[model samples]
Target: MSYEVTGKLVAKYDTVQRTETFKTREFVIEKSDDIGGRIINNYVKFQCVQDKTALPDKFNIGDDIKVSFNLKGTKWSKDGRENYITNLDAWRLEAAGSLAQTAINNAPDNFVPDAAPDDVVDDLPF
Candidate 1:
């Protein structure tokens, strides 16, 4: 399964040659959420491997971006010790809000959205 996240690009790293035939790149994004009356920020790091290593090239730091990724976990034994690693493998990345804005911008000038009138009654009670 895949998941998507939208946040501000915080940091990007150079592509790394993990193996003779394998390469990977990593980047970080800042995600903030409101909890109670305080705000919490989370810095999430994601990895792109192989052909996807260059995925972050077109985007600059501090840009609002949406990332589509898959959750990956691996287990291995090294020197009689069990080791586990988890990676957020990002496959698709794009501007967070540009896609939706582009659709609205491409709409014909004469196009008018169907919405409630100014005097629409509010019938719902709290």
Candidate 2:
């Protein structure tokens, strides 16, 4: 099955040639959220293989990106022992929230002049 996730790109590694015909590249994304006034962070890594290894080259680190990937699993047996591995195989990448950030960045600056003295507290509903 395929899944999608949006997060800030944290780290990207160079493409590695596993074998003569098999090559892969991996990258990490950081997903953070606020819960109960505390910030939680999650780092997820994904792999791109073959021609897709270059998928992340266009985007720089720290860019918010939406990754579309497929969940892949493999079973390996060696010395009568069996092991399984799971990989998030990313196929496509697109810049996330650039338009919104650009719009907010392009807006005119709003300056608020402080006209009241210190300790003057307004009544605000809590």
> Candidate 1, clashing residue pairs?
none
Model 1 ranges off by over 4 Å: 98-126
Candidate 2: where are CA atoms >4 Å away? 99-126
Model 2 global lDDT (CA atoms, 0 to 1): 0.89
The residue-level lDDT of candidate 1 at 123 comes to 67
* Each model's Cα RMSD: 10.1, 14.3
- The local distance difference test score of each candidate is 0.89, 0.89
lDDT of 2 by residue, 50-89 (tens): 9999999988899999899999999999999999999999
